[model samples]
Target: MHIETQLAQHRVTGLRAQADAHRLSTEAKPPVELRTRVGWTLVELGLRLASAPGPAPAVA
Candidate 1:
C-alpha cells in the first residue's frame, strides 16, 4: 500500500531536517552524502521492521 500524504510529508520534513543537520556540519562530508545516508538508513530500518513477524491468529 502507498504511504498517506501526511506520512509522506512527515518523511519529507525529516529528510529536510537531516539535510539541514548535515548542512551545519563543518566536516568534509557533503550535505548530499548525508542526505543519501540518512535516507538509505531510514529505508533499511523500514524494510527490517516490515519484514519482522507480527502477531499470529488466535484460537477459534
Candidate 2:
C-alpha cells in the first residue's frame, strides 16, 4: 500500500511537471514592444487624421 501510494504521488508530481512544461512552452510568448511601436506610431499619426484623410478609422 505504501509503495502504491508513493507511485501515485510520483505520477502526480510527474504530471504536474509535464503540465508546467507545456504551460511555459505555450505561454512564453515574445514581447509585444515591436508590434506595439508600430501600432502606437499609427495611432499617433491617426490622431490628426481628420485633416489628413478622407475617412480614418477609430483608434483604440
Candidate 3:
C-alpha cells in the first residue's frame, strides 16, 4: 500500500511537471497577429471610453 501511494504520487508529480512545461511553452509564443492585437486594443479603448463618466453639469 505504501509503495502504491508513492508510485501514484510520483506519477501525479510527473504529470504536473509535464503540464507546467506545456503551459510555459505555449505562453512563450503568443499566437495573436499584429492586426488582431491592434483590433483588440482598439476594442478595449473604445469600451473604456464608452464606459467613462461624462463631465459634470455647470452650477449656476
Predicted structure with the largest lDDT when compared to the true one? 3
Residue-level lDDT for 16 in candidate 2: 100
Every candidate's lDDT: 0.87, 0.88, 0.97
* Clash count of each predicted structure: 0, 0, 0
Residue 18 of model 1, lDDT score: 94
TM-score of 1: 0.42
TM-score, one value per model: 0.42, 0.46, 0.54
Higher-ranked by TM-score: 1 or 2: 2
Model 2 lDDT tens row, 16-50: 99999999988898767888989998988878785
Output the lDDT of residue 10, model 2.
Answer: 97
Please give the lDDT score for candidate 1: 0.87
Across 1-60, the per-residue lDDT of candidate 1 in tens digits comes to 356988999999999999988877757654578888899999999999999998997989
- Total clashes in model 3, counting residue pairs 3 or more apart in sequence or in different chains: 0
- lDDT (Cα, 0-100) at 58 in candidate 2: 79
Candidate 1: regions farther than 4 A off: 1-32
Candidate order by lDDT, decreasing, is: 3, 2, 1
Error of 1 at 5 (Å): 66
